[model samples]
Target chain A: MTLIAADFGKLGRSTLMSVASMLALAILAPVLVAALRADSIPAVKLNADQIAPRAIEELTGRNVTRDYAYAWRDLAAASESARADLLNDYFTGFAKDKLVRRIADQQKTGVRIRYIDHGHNVRALFYAPDGGEMQLVDNAQLEIEIRDGSKIIYREKVNQQYLVLMTPGADRWFVRSLDQLADHP
Target chain B: MAKMHSLVFVPALALSLVSSAQVPTLQVPARLIAGQAFTIPTHGQGEKTFYLLGPGSVVKRTVELGTEVKVTGAEIAAAGRYLALSCGSDGCSGTDFFVLPGDAVKISFLLHPSRVPVTAHNAINATAFVFDQFHNPVLRPVTVDFRVLPKNGPAFTKSVKTVQGVAWSEMSPAAKEGPVKVIATVGEQEEPRVIQQVASEACNLRIKARRTSKGVEVETDPVRDCHGNAVPDGTIVSVTAVDAQGRTTVDAPVKKGIARTQLPIHGSATISVASGVAIGNEIKL
Candidate 1:
């Protein structure tokens, strides 16, 4: 009876060791497979040409360019009462006030400034680290007519350069300042 | 006492004579056209130098007083307000006048968009600016006739009066696909322009598909409008495939003439296509 009991204990110890080894293999098998699979796959290195056509740097600048075009169009197309409402989307602070005053003065003088054709080239000058402010320089060709009362007193083609400051708002970028560079013709 | 009185009286008399001398009077026309000969009348004695200042020009000449100063078109070519000053040994006087625009010599006509889709209430604007020979904008109210010639359709005509040197009108494009000719006429001067009219949208869009090695290849017939005109290239056509696994969609643009896409199908599926708001017939595979 002692020999038989000692033999049963030895068998139990061997069976426990086998079960523990099996359990450890079961746990480590998935990790080993995953590592091997990861090693088999090639590392991806993206070239500049493979990047998206519209880079992150250009996204905000494009919005400002489109808004600038619309702002000038609204100025030429809106009525007296509607001018302020139309321009509210494009300008802010002192720029907005200045545009409003200019429109009012034009209305009082019976002056209508019509924009015939406008084309512009925008170059990004600076972008703030916080992404709050942006500066752009625009070189533009403008065909315009200046009318006084019932007479178009002046008509010409003008080449203009502007230093534009913009700030991001809740919906779109707003023009903080549009100062005309005096050096351009 | 007599000599003292004469001294005081002589100085006073001289002062009165100088002050009483008639100031030169200048006569100028109230309105003059640009690039036209004009004359300014002055009244005085002895030779007087006159300076004429106007937009884009300046003239200084000595002329006999009581005569007129003649100016040619080249001298007073620019249209704006002008000032003429007469300065003599006796006194100085000045007068101002306005220069108006001359007759229409050329027309600047602009048509927006350069292309349009044929739909009612889709408006295209035509704006005209009449200019003089010297390129000055003519301010007078002139009648302008706008004519639109459509392919295989009746031509449209309208007359508009210029206000502040501009005449603009809005017209709807014809309901057909072809080149459109627009002409603006004022007297003998005419400006001709062209705009391309394209089909409105895709209608009756239908597609067919067959099994391929890669996936289920599906392609649309040449898309057409209700009038049977082929939809222009680059119009977006959307294709959707629905199977046991959910749905996949591809928005393909029309190239050459059709929009085609391949979808991987697991089991029996349904395919549908659409262009703009127009939906096409669906097929079960």
Candidate 2:
């Protein structure tokens, strides 16, 4: 939490005390709300124009978008809480292994990350003929905060690009890979 | 190749710091290999906390502001975007960079249709995704070799080009009914999958009949499929005989490549045989 203390030296003693308290609370309230509230589903728009071998069925398109949103929500929650089990629902294979390792590493180094997801524009690049895997390019908007315990070390808003791979499981689509790209189309 | 991605930290909370214009900028490589050690030169004085965030890792350390900060290769082994941040009393300055994958050394191969009929066309599919040692997909194009080794034919190999780390090819089943092994190769990595090619519908299912003590003994010649493959033993073969005693039918299982059955017939009799969708020649006795 940050309070406006720059101008407090010029103000009166009592006024300065009250103003500092108000400023601290005002800034602290939003941070608390943002951290404590449950992560809502982020908007995910999928474009399958380039998918090959088989055109994406309408139902598959709907299901993939909804599941991708759920994955983002879960990812945000997992990163903030450093809870690896939370990823089991929507993550599998390499994606799950990497995030789980990251959480473990975070706990070791006393570091944490928070992702405030905005939305995503995902383009489907490849769909295996046998329906085992799908590759996508995702352009995402997110606010990321790196923290050392209660101290916010760095925060930024980024337009990130990711190479994503999703595989179908028994009940839902699982994210197998989510690799950040350097703005390549 | 040296590539770099830089991120200037923008405020996420209400806490505003020194204007981004005044915040000290640091020097870092534009691009890095997936598993290589690197350093960032810091400026100013005093000690500051350095945090390196990347895929599958979060590294934090305290270093003297003016000295070079050493980052181990294991800290940022995963390929993707990485952020290097230095936090001091004045606030933090963050820069982002990219880590590209190494050469394609591994492959995840998927072969479909574990069993198919010999008559099927383009029934086997092989799709392979190339990867680095760290399990990151290699975005660059590469050629994948698909080797087909049939149970009873000369083996052949075909090459396909990967698009965005994935390549696929479809193959027709060999005429000979047996198992075919398909192997996908990338660099030194090889993955193999096997699919069975079973016989198609049985054809040339003609049977000969002769009078026996108990009844008319009818036995079929060797049953072969349209592709000339011997029908597998235990396949059902139906035999029917018609006489003054009305019609008699017996469903017999082929054993030793042929099926034999007895049907009680009186006086003149007509006999016929069938297997699957193929009908055999009729015999009159």
Candidate 3:
């Protein structure tokens, strides 16, 4: 009986110690990994303007259709920044040409897209296919009429919503899917 | 005993603590279930585990924790001792949990059985038959995924598949009155997959009349229902008798189940039943 008790005590102590060690390791390992990897984590961000000119020119040389197809491909390849650039080019072109004629025109006449805002990693510029350096502006708008003062500009109304994506590398921002805003004009 | 209890409770307590932290953190919407297979959001995936518990301590089976799991069908056997889930062996054990969509939280019982019903509403006769996943007649309220296919017509390729799911009709009276073919798929693991098909005839207003040896008989017998049931008796019956050139004689108060008035020696009178009648038969009255 004494031998059995001694053996049980020894087994219990080992099991308790092993389980405690496992639990402590599980709890501490992630923290340790985070600390070691902290330097690699994002500290500064790159906006569209700050993006490498070579990367921008490589992206812009492709037409809008090619840009979108390449964007989808890049997204599949996990090159999210390239995808963002392609998307920016596509939307900028769309806003310059289609937004006024199709969307804003339906509400009122002679509507123009002003200056589009690109923040963080987003690059906003209007691309004219048959061009000689046309001025691409941010025609996107945001309204907080209920809390803030409301104002109407031009014959057409615009509403813009932007989203910020914080990934392991850095923080990048982009516009949501586009549709023109109208204010009972 | 306290130590033993702690051994059991500690894990559960820790799991609850972990889950509470996670509940508000996840922004993913509930999963949309497709036929048989469910796609989990690969949150940097290797294996994602979920638990499937039976009535009480009974654990039917554990499924693989992977990005994709397919459920061909399911059935209740042994009065619900085990849920026979259909799948290829992918490291499933009885002790493991069956991962289901988050909506499953709405349910209290694990082994809830649902049924798919097919009713022939406007069938002229009782030739209509309803078959379950096993091709058996089921006459109880059931919750299951269903698809509708028309006879000699293209079957709807897309089906509404739901888990944590009940046929809306099973829970509400309004769903029963509809004319729809419902197919139900269910099960847990192993040989428990089943597919049930239900056919319902739409409720339609139809008029039927037969000529008897007796003079110009006009009666509403076997009122056709669009949903495949014979029309009930005493539904306000009105009928019109018209001569060849559209000269008409409208009759009054022909009861729904039986509407009849003898017409004098007729040379093919066009008999038309009223639109308000559940069913109307056109015959020489």
Clashes of each: 0, 6, 49
Give the runs in model 1 whose Cα sits over 4 Å from its true position. A1-185, B1-22, B29-31, B39-50, B55-70, B87-91, B244-247, B264-267
lDDT of 1 by residue, A1-185 (tens): 99998997988988988999999999878665421111111111111121111232555645666677665565445422224566787788545654565566455545555565456665554443335555555565666554445544334465555545567889788876554432211
lDDT of 3 by residue, B1-285 (tens): 111111111111001111211222111223211112332222233443332211111112223433434322221100111111111223211111221211121111111112223342222110111213222212122333333333333444222222112211121111232233334333321111122223222134344445555435555444444445433344455656677556554354435434555544246667776646233446654
- lDDT, residue A136, candidate 2: 80
What proportion of true contacts does candidate 1 retain?
0.00
| Residue B247 shift from truth in candidate 1, angstroms | 4.2
lDDT (tens digit, per residue) of candidate 3 on A2-77: 9998987988988988999999999877666421211111111222342211133433423322332332232222
In candidate 3, residue B130 scores what lDDT?
20
Query: In candidate 1, which residue pairs clash?
Result: none
Highest-TM-score candidate = 2
Tens-place lDDT digits, model 2, residues B1-285: 001112222222232322253466567888788878988998888998888888889888899988999988787778988777777777777677778888899999999889888998987889998999888888777999999999899999999988778889988998889999999999999999999898889887889999988889999999988879988899999999888889999999999998999888857999999887789999999
TM-score, chain B, predicted structure 3: 0.24
lDDT of 3 at A69: 31
Docking class of 3: incorrect
The clash tally of candidate 3 reads: 49
Off by over 4 Å in 3: A1-141, A145-185, B1-218, B225-229, B232-238, B242-248, B251-256, B261-285
Worst 10 residues of 2 chain A by lDDT: A1-10
